[model samples]
Target: MRQNPERRTALLDAAIEVLAREGSRGLTLRAVDKEADVPIGTSSNYFASRDTLLTQAGARVYERLLPDEATVAQQMSSAVGTEGFVYLMREAMTRISGFRTGYLALLELRLEATRRPELREVLTKRVRADMDENVERHLASGLPGDAVSVRLLQLTLSWLILEQLTLPDIMTDEERDELVTEAVLRLSAPSKRE
Candidate 1:
């Protein structure tokens, strides 16, 4: 079947809106069709199955959660000292806060993948690719061969930010910054294993 980018975009946007407003349980073809103002049949035509539609929608949400390479690199580069790191951390936390539902959906998808090996493999591949690219960029900035450490740092920081964003009342900004700073220091410290 010939693809329609505009229609696809519309469907994806509608899916996000539905997922955000209604959560996973509320996702339905009729709801998405109404959200997109497209016919129910059109949604089914574009996405043959609920799994297909949810997976694609979840991917879109994941992409939206992470900043682009250039943006991340620039942030990392400009964030020289501890203060700068805090600024970058705060910015990242803020961005994640803006996409709370998307992040939640991503977490759900990741959990779902555990039961579905094929889905898990696909997500793992994408995550590894993203981590590899980020690791390369971080290494190119004159850091030591700390790809593993850097990847761990990225994952830890991302989860921290997601946690803070999802449950703002649980941690104050100052407390969060202190935690992040401590994590960065420990992760970047000289390692006996290395």
Candidate 2:
């Protein structure tokens, strides 16, 4: 197998694009090679099998979608109460939605994971780790949510994002923004004293 890290990354990036545009069923080594504009056998040299490519692509999507440290720090600094939680969730929704292709490819990876155990393992681990981190961050940042609230936001916002990505025409941007705000406020509001 080739050991050029740069080339491998390039192929994975291409695979992501192919996955987003073509869905999981259309993902092929030859398709990746074409998308990368490398020789016909280039992707094969970098990846041993279709499963390898699928798993790697799943990892790559998160790698590409992760917010940079500076952004995280900036966002974390401003987080305060319910409003702060609202801002944080809105920012998160914006950031995640901004990378349309990465998220779309991730959707493809999720569909493919059902048929491929290795891919399923990789995605489950990555997603779980991400959720754990988000829960910890929400707790530490003094956001208005408990771990349960954070988890709920994760589920609700994810579906909203899915709707935004797949059938954006269904709702206006302002309506989506309202939904995010409502979810955060309702889910994270302080409980009444007993």
Candidate 3:
């Protein structure tokens, strides 16, 4: 079928909302159409089946979850150094905090992926590719971190982000920043392997 990018995006966004609010079990084409406020068949027209919708919706959620240009630039810029790294982490936190619903949907996607190996493969591929790109960016910037180190840093920050946002009173903004800063410092420190 011919495609309308705008309509597809709208349906995917609605799917994300449904996933975040009602979770994977509630992700149906009709529900997506209803969420999008389009006619009842709109989601089906865009997606072939519920599995397709779920997989594409997972991809869409991850796509939107990526950091923007400014954030990427800060992370890639050389003048920032370790301090710049901390700033990048803070910028990420700020953006993620603002996109709480999107993040929730992403978490929902992960939960759904766990039950479906095909979906899990798709997500893990995308996520690992993203992480590899992040490590390359850091290396290109002359930052000190290999893929493994960058992976550790990213995972640490991701868990911290999830907790600080999902669990109230876990840590204040400054406290989280300090924690990430420390992690970055340790990661950037010259290692025997380096």
Q: lDDT of all predictions, in order shown?
A: 0.73, 0.92, 0.83
Q: How many collisions per candidate? A: 0, 0, 0
lDDT of 2 at 109: 97
The best-first sequence of candidates by lDDT reads 2, 3, 1
Best by TM-score: 2
TM-score to native of every candidate shown: 0.81, 0.96, 0.90
Q: How far is candidate 1 from the true structure (C-alpha RMSD, Å)?
A: 2.7
C-alpha lDDT (0 to 100) for residue 60 of candidate 2: 93
Q: Which lDDT value does model 2 have at 4?
A: 100
| Pick by lDDT: 2 or 3, better one | 2
The better-scoring model by TM-score among 1 and 3 is: 3
Model 3: lowest-lDDT 10 consecutive positions = 71-80
Give me candidate 2's TM-score against the actual structure.
Answer: 0.96
